[model samples]
Target: NAGVTQTPKFRILKIGQSMTLQCTQDMNHNYMYWYRQDPGMGLKLIYYSVGAGITDKGEVPNGYNVSRSTTEDFPLRLELAAPSQTSVYFCASSYHGGGYNEQFFGPGTRLTVL
Candidate 1:
């Protein structure tokens, strides 16, 4: 089953630029999240959406934003990117909600800022 998929497996950007981390799921799941994974570190949740029309910020939401208008698409937007945002971003989804622990993650989108 196709769980989650992210685009631009690798990328390089300049300072003050922006990009969107695309996230899509074919399972028709209801929960989705966008997280940034730094070198040798656990994934840090940036933003998440419980369902369409419902979104919220996570642990680290600074410089990032998101909108959930559909169950299958939850994209992460970075406005005014910085070097600090040059990390591997991952998109994930789950079939359940309310603190569900089983989350399926995409390969990742590695971004590098120069």
Candidate 2:
């Protein structure tokens, strides 16, 4: 299986612009998440879903949104992007949810908002 895949591996946006970072997994994993890492900082969760029809905001969910309509896709949307939103975005997945959160990650999408 391809595990997880994210498209447009890189992106640059003007402040106030918007974009969607696509994420998909083939592991049939039930848990999906979106996280951002700013330079040397640890990964900050943006949003996550325990399963289809279930979603929750994470630690740093500002300016971001996510949805889990299926077991395979969990895309992230950025609205009115700002320079402060510039970071490396990672999409991850794991088996089950509301428990241990060990996740399998994607190669990541680097987004630069100027």
Candidate 3:
């Protein structure tokens, strides 16, 4: 059922450019999240949404924005991208919040800013 899907598996962007990473899940999950992983660091949450029309910023939301207008779609927007923003972004979804439920992650989108 396409648990989760992300477009443009890989991207190369010039510094100061903007882009949008698309994420969609067909599982009807109640929780959706956006995370970024640096070369040698753990995943850091950028944004999350508990449900449609309910969104919140996460640990690292400085250069990004997210919107969850529907349960199945959560898109991340990156404005004025910088080299530090170059990382593999992952989109995940779960039926429940917290650690109670297993989150299904989509194949990450590798972004490179030069």
Best by TM-score: 3
Candidate 3 accuracy as TM-score: 0.98
Give the count of colliding residue pairs in each prediction: 0, 0, 0
Q: For each candidate, what is the lDDT? A: 0.89, 0.91, 0.96
Candidate 3: residue pairs that collide: none
Model 2, residue 60: distance off in Å is 0.6
Candidate 1 per-residue C-alpha lDDT over 32-93 given as tens digits, one digit per residue, 9 for 90 to 100: 98989999999999998889999998999999999988899998888888898989999999
TM-score of each: 0.94, 0.94, 0.98
Q: Per-residue CA lDDT of candidate 2, range 51-113, in tens?
A: 988999999988888878888999899999999998999999999675566789999999999
* Model 2: ten consecutive residues of lowest lDDT: 95-104
Ranking by lDDT: 3, 2, 1
TM-score winner between candidates 1 and 3: 3
lDDT agreement of model 2 with the native: 0.91
Highest lDDT: which candidate? 3
Candidate 3 lDDT over 10-70, as tens digits, reads 9999999999999999999999999999978999999999999999999999989888889
